[model samples]
Target chain A: MNKPSVFDDFYSVIPAGGIGSRLWPLSRADAPKFLHDLTGSGKTLLRDTWDRLVPLSGVDRIMVVTGRAHRAAVEEQLPDLLDPNVVLESEPKDSSAAIGLAAAILLRREPNVIVGSFAADHVIKDMRGFRRAVAEGVAAARAGYIATIGITPTDPAIGFGYIQCGDPLSIAGAPNAVTVRSFVEKPDLETAERYLAGGDHLWNGGMFIAKADVLLEQLGKAEPALLAGLTELAEAWDTPRRGAVVDRVWPGLTKVAIDYTVAEPAAAAGKLVVIPGDFDWDDVGDFASIAKLHSGGRKSDLAILGENARVLADASTGVVISQSGRLISLIGVTDIVVVDTPDALLVTTTANAQRVKSVVDALKLSGRDDVL
Target chain B: MNKPSVFDDFYSVIPAGGIGSRLWPLSRADAPKFLHDLTGSGKTLLRDTWDRLVPLSGVDRIMVVTGRAHRAAVEEQLPDLLDPNVVLESEPKDSSAAIGLAAAILLRREPNVIVGSFAADHVIKDMRGFRRAVAEGVAAARAGYIATIGITPTDPAIGFGYIQCGDPLSIAGAPNAVTVRSFVEKPDLETAERYLAGGDHLWNGGMFIAKADVLLEQLGKAEPALLAGLTELAEAWDTPRRGAVVDRVWPGLTKVAIDYTVAEPAAAAGKLVVIPGDFDWDDVGDFASIAKLHSGGRKSDLAILGENARVLADASTGVVISQSGRLISLIGVTDIVVVDTPDALLVTTTANAQRVKSVVDALKLSGRDDVL
Candidate 1:
C-alpha cells in the first residue's frame, strides 16, 4: 500500500469578511482587508491565505466563506477556487455562522474530513513552521480534540487575546499539543506582560482545526439554535436553492465570534488542545502592526507599501500606505501613519492607530458612505 | 481745485515671484503660494493683495511684476488688472530686478508716482491699520526718504529680519515714522528675543515705499548694472519691442533682493524711514504660520482650509489644506500639518515646517520635477 500523506482528507476554510476599520481609507466597506496586499508580497491577503493552505489541504479541498459583496473579488484573487467550494454569506452573521456553516457543509461532503479555519487577512512569514503547527493541530483534531494553533508570544502585546495551556497531550504525530486551560480576552498591559513572562500563555490567533463533525458537535453544545440554523443552510448549499435559503436564514443567525461559540466552551469541557506555533504571525490589525511588520523592529525606519507608491521621506520614521498613486512626502515626522487612498486620506501617529476606527465611526455618523 | 484723495499719485507694486517651497505640494513651482487661498477666504492671496491695496492705490495704479509663466494665472486672478500695468519677466531675476524694473517702468510712465512694493502673499488682518501705516510710509516717501513699513514685533520671531529705528521723522500725517538706523538680517533666537526686549527694533516686512526715481537712484548706487538693465527694459516696456528687450536683458540682470539693493544701503545713507505698522501681519512663510494664522492662537484647534475638503478630525490640533477634494481624517495628532493635493501629499509637524523645503529639494534631486 502507498504511504498516506499527512494532509490526507484535510480541508482549509477561509472566513474573509472584515472592514478592518483601523486600516481605514485603504480597507473600505466594499473592499475589506483581505482583498489588499498588505504585506507588500504582490498578492492579496486572501490569495496568500489560499496559497498557504494549498500545501496542506490541496487546491480542491480549500473552501472560502466570504460576504456576497466580495464574491467576485475573492474569485478574481483566487481563480482556482472551485464554484462548489465557495460559500457566500448574504450579510455578515459573524464568525460563528460563517465557520459553523462551512464545517456543516464539509461534514456533509465527507463526514470524517478534518477542517481548519484560518483568517484570510493574516500574515505568516515562516511557511515551514506554520505548516508544521497545522500538521500537529490536524493530528490533535484526528484524536477527537478541537485544536487551535496558539502563536508563541514574542512581546507583551495587549492587542490580541491569550490562550492559556495546561498539561501536554501526547497525541500521535502531535507531541507539542497541550490541553487548553482557558481562552482569555485581550488583557491590560500588566496582564499581557505577565502572560508574556509566564510562558504558559500564547497569543490566540483564532486558527482552529477539527474534524467537521467534531466542530459541529462543539457548536451544537454551545449554541444549538445557531448550529441548527447553520446545518439547515449547509444542507441546501449544494443545491439550486442555496440563494433562497441563505437570503432567508442569514439575517436571523446569531452574531457571535467562534472564540465564544466554540473555543471557550470546548476549552471549559477539556475537549480543546493548543499546538504551539512558534511562527511569525500578524492579523495586520492596524497601521502600527503594519509598521512593525515591515520595519523589522527598526524604530527609525519608514515602511512604505504600494505598487506605484512614490514616497520621499527625510528624517522620518513611520508607515505610509499609498493607494492613490500620489507622491507621499514626509519630513521630520516620527512614528506617524499616513494612508492615502483615492477618495480619502488618514493621518495619525502609531500610538493612536487604534483610534482610527473612531474616524470611520464619525464618517458613518455623518452619512458619508460614499467614501466609506 | 478738487481735494485730493490720500492715495492720489500713489501706486502699488506687487512683486509676486517666489515659489514658497516651504508650503510644498500645495505650493508648486507652476502654482506658487500667492495663487492659493491659504486663509480659507474666497480669494487667492494675490487677489487679497489687490483688494487690500485698492483703497490705498486705486485699481488703475496697481502694478504686478511676476514671471511670464504665471502671467495667465495672475491675469485670471486679477481681471481688473490693466495689461499695460503688468510687467512679465521672462524668468525670475530676484526681488530687486522685479521691483526695480517695475520702479523704472513707473518712473518712465509718470515721474512723481510714489510706488509701494507690497508682497503679493503676506496676510494683513487689520486693513485700517495697514492703510494707516502705508499712508504714513507714503508721507515719508514724499519727503524724499525711502520708506518701509516696519511691523511692530508681537513675539520673539526669528523668522523675520529686524529693522532698527533711530529718532522720529517729522513728516506730516506720519507721526509713527522713524529713521531706519539699519536693516538687520534674520537673527538667532536669543538675538531675536533681545531685539524684541530692546524696543528699538521692528520686523522688516519688506513693505517699501519710495518715489520711482528715488528707488532707481538707490538701486543705481547699490547695483548700477541692475538699474541700467532694468532702465533699458522699462524704456522698451510700452513699445512693440518689449518682449525682445526682456528676452535680451532679463537673464543678464543682477539677482538681488530689494532689501540688499535698496533698504540696507538707504538705511546706511541715513535716507530710509521706518513706519511702525501696528497691524497684524504675517508673511505666510511656512505651515507654522498657516497654523497660527488659521488657528487664531487657539492651540488645540484644527484649522482646515479647502472649498471641497471633507475632514473628520478628533483630538487633533493642526492645519490641513486639502485641495484634492478628498476626505481627510486625523486622529490624536498634535501640531501636525497635512497638505493634500491631487498629485502629492505632505505630512509633517508644524515644528518642522521649514524643513519641507528639503523634501522639495530631494524631489528635485531625483528629477521628479513633474510634481514640482
Candidate 2:
C-alpha cells in the first residue's frame, strides 16, 4: 500500500454540548465544560480540540456542530473556522443528531468526504499519537467501514463504555484496524476489571471516523425517520429555508447517542472497525478526571487550576480547586473537589464526583437557574 | 442577710480582641470573629454579648476596652455604650492589661464598686441563667473574693481550661459560688474524661467578677509593671492626656491572659471562687463549634449558615457552608466545612476544622494577606 492522501477529502466535526454536570458550578449552562480551561492550560478545551485537528484537517475543513446559544462562543474561540462550516442545532438531540447533521451537511457539499466526529471537550494528550490513530481510522473509513478510535484501557474504569476487538481488517494504510466485536455500556467494577484483564477491550470515547455517505446510510438503515428528517434539513441548510425547516424538524428528531444510533448498530452489521488509540485520552467527565489530569499521573495531594486560585493544602490529598480569583484553602481534607465560581461553589469528595449531576438536577428542581 | 444594692456600685468590663484565627477566611485581622454574625443570628457576636449583659450592667456602666482599629466598629455595634466607656487601647496587650485598665478606671470613679469582666466574643444560650450566675458571682465578689463563672461541663471537652471547684461558699445570695481549688489548662482526653467524671471541673469561660480595687490589687501583685501601665492609662482615660498616656504605656504592658496574671495567682492566695454557670456556653472558637451551633443538638447531616446559601447534600453528614450570596453544593462529602466568601473559599472537614488557623498562618507566610 502507498502513502494515503487521507487529508485530501477529510473533514472534522466537533460536537460541543452538555453542561458537564459532574463538574457542576464551574461547568454551567452558559459556560459548559467545553468552554472551560479544565487542564489549567492557556486554551479552552474546545480551542484545544480544534488545535489538535488543525494539522490533520485544516481549519476550514473542520466544522463545529453546537447549540445556537454556543455558536457565538465557538466562533469567538475559532476565528479561522469559516461561518458556513458551523452547523448550528436549534436544540440538543444528543450525539446522533449533532454528528448526523454535520455528516449530512458535509456529504451534500463534498459527496465523497470522510467526516471524523470528535468531542470538543475531551482531551488527547499526545497529538502525534492521536494524528496517527485518526489517519488509520480515516483509512478504514475510506474502505467502507464506520471507523471508531478505541482508546487502549489505562485503568479498570467503570465510568466509560468499552469496545471489544475482533478479527483484524486487511484494509490498505490501516494495518491496526480491527472489526469491533461489541460495544458495551458502562460496566460495574467487576466487569471493568475483567475487561481490563482480557486485553481485547478498549474505551469507546465517542470518536467516530466514517465516510459521510456511509454514516448517513447507516442512520437511514437503523432509523429511517431520523435519516429522512436530517436529509430534509441538510437540503435546506444552505438556503434561506434552513431556519424554517430546522424549526419544524429539529425537535422531532430522535435524541440518542451516535453509539446507540450508529456505532453499536453498525457493529452488529459487521461494518464498524476499532482503530487503537495509543495516546492518553480523557472525556474529563467529572472533577476526579480533572484532578487526575492536573496530577499529571503522579497522584498529587492537591491539584489547582486557573491563575487566580492560591491553594494552601494541609494534610490533604487528591483535592482539586478550579476557581475565579479566590484563595482556596484546603485543610485536612482528603480526596475532595472544590469548584469555586463567582456566584456558586461546589464541594464534594472524589468518590461522589459523579453525583455532582444530582446537585445540578436539584438546583434545576429548586428553580435556581441564576446559579445553574 | 440584707440584699446589698449591687447595681449601684457595679460596672462591667468587656475586653474585645483576638481575630479567632481558627475561624479564618471568615474572621480576619480587620474584621475579627466578634464583628461577624457567626451564628447566622441577626446580631453579631459583640452585639449579642452586649445584649446579654445589658440587663445586669446598664449600658453606661459597661466599659469596652478594644483596639483603636475596632473602636469605630465597636461603637457602631454598641450604640448605647457611652463614648467615655469605650476605652480605646493604642494596641492589644492581652486580656490582663485590657481588664486591668477597665478595673482601674472604675475604681477611680467609684472606689468600692464591683466589676464583672466578660469577653465580647463568647455565646451564652440562656439569658436568665447567665444573669443568675453573674448575680451569684457578684455576691461572692462583695464577700471579698475574685469570682468567675465556670460553665457546667456538658462533655469531656479538652479544648477549654477547667476550673476545679472545692466547696460551696457561705455568702448570702451566692448559693452556687464555690471556692476555686485551681485553674488547670486544657487537659488531655484521659485527664478531661477524669475531670468530667470527678464532677469538680467546670470550663473556665474567662468571666470574672470582683471589686474593682480587688482585681487591680491582684493584678498589681501578679504583674506590677503591667498594673502600673494600666493605672497610668486609666488615670488619664477621662482626661485630655488619655491619648498620650495610652500611646506611651499600652505597648509596654505584659501580653498575658487574665487567667495567668490574676485568676491563677489569686486562686492560689485563697481569694478566688467559681460561680457555676448553668447556661449553655461556647467560645465559638472554630468551625466545629459553628457546626454544632447550627446543628443545635439535633445532629443534622448538614448545617448551613448565611443567607442565599443553597446547599445540596447527598450522602454527606455534618457539613457546614457559610457563604456569600451564592449557592453552595455539597455531595458525598461527610463532616466537611465549606466557607465561601467574596475573595476567599475554604474547604475542610470538621475533623480538621481547628487547623483553619494553620491555613491563616500559611497564608500570612505566603504573603497572601489579600485573602487573610
Candidate 3:
C-alpha cells in the first residue's frame, strides 16, 4: 500500500520573507513569521513547509530563498537541507527576484525541472490533498503551462486575491487542471460574495509551479533586465563569487511580486493553468486567524500559544501568544488578542487584529528601533 | 504677614494596606497600590499622603500602619518618618485594628492629641481644600465629636460608600461640620442616582479625625476585647517588649473596617459628625478611575503610566500600566486596560476593570503564587 513518489524532478523553492507586521511582537523583522511555531503544531511554519515538501521533492531538491539576515536561522531550522541549495539574497527584491533566481539556478542544472514556489509561512493541514494538487500542477507544468495551485474558496474573504478559472485543460495526469482566465485583486465584500457564490473563482494563495526553463523564459519576456541579472547571478551561484554577485545585483534588481510579473502576464497571454487545491490552508495573517486555527475542534474559545506559556483565562475568548515566561491572565473580555514578548506586548481585539500594523508603523515613526 | 502652621497637636495616621486586586500586575501582594505612582504625578500614593500631612502635622507626628512585608518599602518611601511611628502588623487585621492601634499608641503618648486617620492610597488634588476640610474636622474633634471628612459627590458613583449628612452643627470654627445621619453601603445605579440628587449624600472616603482617647473609647464601646488588646500592645510599643506584645495580641484582634466598627456605631450613638470636603478625590478603585485621573487635561484619551515605559498607542483609549520596562503598543482598541509587569500581564478593558479580581482569583486557584 506504499504510494509511489511522483515528483522526482520537482524542486520546491520556498520564498521565506515578510515580517508579518499584523502579528507583531511575535513576528519581527529579524525573526519573521516563518521561524515561529505559530500554529501550536510543535514545529515552525518553515519547518512544516520543509516536511511537506520532503515527501514530494525530497530534501536535496528543495531550495530556500531568504534574506541574508535569516540565513543562519533557516539553516538551523532545516539542518538536512543541502547547503548548495540555500539561496541567500543581500536584500529583499520582492518575490519576482527571489523566485526567478531560484528557477534560473535550478534550470542551469536541469533544463526541464518542474519548480514549485511556496511561501515559507503558510499553514496546510491536509498533506494528501496538497500532494495531489502538487502532482497535478507538476503534470501541467511539464505540458508548457505555468501552473498554479488555487485554493477552493470556502468563504467570501476580502483579504485574499481571487483567480478566475476558465475551460478545463486536457493535460495528462492533471484532471483537475483548468486554464486561468485572469488573476484579480482582493475585492470588496460584495464582489467577494459574488465570486464565492458564482463558483468560478478560487483564492490565489501565491503558490506557483512551472518548468525552470519556461519560468525563466517568461521572466525574460516580461522584464528583460530582471531576467538578465538573475541569469548572470545563477551562473555564478555555484562558484565562490555567490556572495559578491548577490550583493551587487540583488539591490539593483526590480522589486515586484510573482503574481504581477509572471502569473498575471502569463494568464493574459493564455499560457497559465490552475489546479484546484481543496485542502485547509491559512497564511496566519493576524491573531484572529491564529485564534481560529488553534481553536479548531476545541470547546474553549481561548487559544494559548508558546511552549512554556502560563495562561489562566476565565470567561474570556481570544488568542494569547506568550513568548515571554510570564503568566498571562484574561477575564471577561471576548475576542481579545494579547501577544506577550520579553521586550514588547500587544493588546487589541480580534476585530482590530489587522490594524496591528499601524502600531508597528507608529513605533517606527517614534524611532523605537529597539522594540521594532 | 505670614500664615502660621495650624493645629500644632494634630497627628496624622496613614493606614497603608490592601493588594488592590482589581489593578492586578500593577498592584500585587508584595508591592501594593500605595507603593506605586498610579497617577503620573512623580510620587507614590504613600509619599503623596506623607507630603500632604506634613504641613498640618510635623513629620514626627505622622504615623504609618502597614504590614510587616512592606515595612522597608514604606520607610524608604518616607525617609523623614520617625522610627517609632511605624506600626507593622504580622498579617492584615483590617482597617479597624490598623487605625485603632495608631490611636491607642498616640493616646498613651498624649491623652487628647487630635488624631487624623487617612488612607495612604487616595488621591487629592486640591491641597488647600483638603487642609480646610481637615481644619474644620479637627475643630469638630476638639469639640468632642468623632468627625469624618465626606467628599462632595461630583457624580453618581456606585464604587464608594455614601454618608448622609443630617442636621448642621453650630460648633465654633467648624461651620461645614454636620451630624452624620447614617453610613450606607455601595448602592445600585438607581440608588446612587437618587443619592446624587438628594444634595445631602457624600462619599465616605475613610478619613476620620478624633481625639486619641475618644477614638479608643468609641472602639472600646463597640468592641471591648479588641480595644483592651490594642491598649495592652500600645503600653509596650516604645519598650523592648513591643515585638512580644504585638505578636501575642495582634493576630487575635477582631478584623473589621473602621467604618463598620467605629463610624457607623458612633453615628448611631449621635457622636459622629461629617465635614464637607470640596476637593477632587479618588480611591483609584480600578483602572477606569486611574485612566480618568491621568487623562484629566490631556487631549488624548490614552493614559500611560510608569517611569521607563515605552508605549506607542494609536487610535486606542484607556489605561496602560507598564512596570516591566517593556514597549507596549495598542491599536484600535477602546476602553482597554493593559497591565504589564515583570512576572505577569493582564489584558482587559475599562468596562471589565472591576472583573479583574476574577482573574486574580483564577490565578490563585491555579496556584500561580509566583505571579500573584
Better of 2 and 3 by lDDT: 3
Worst 10 residues of 1 chain B by lDDT: B1-10
- How does each model score on lDDT? 0.90, 0.86, 0.88
Best by TM-score: 1
TM-score of each: 0.95, 0.93, 0.94
**Best model number under DockQ:** 1
lDDT of 3 by residue, A175-287 (tens): 99998988889898899999999999999988999998888888888899999999999998988998888778878999988888899889988889999999988888888
Candidate 3 per-residue lDDT, tens place, B65-167, comes to: 9999999999999999898898899999999899999999998898879899999999998999999999998898999999999999998887789999999
Residue A4 in candidate 3, Cα distance off native in Å: 4.3
TM-score-sorted candidate list, best first: 1, 3, 2
What fraction of the reference structure's interface contacts does model 3 contain? Answer: 0.89
For model 2, name the residue pairs that clash: B301-B318
Task: Give the worst 10-residue stretch by lDDT in candidate 3 chain B.
Answer: B1-10
The count of backbone overlaps in candidate 1 is 0
Error of model 2, residue A165, in angstroms? 3.4
Rank by DockQ, descending?
Answer: 1, 2, 3
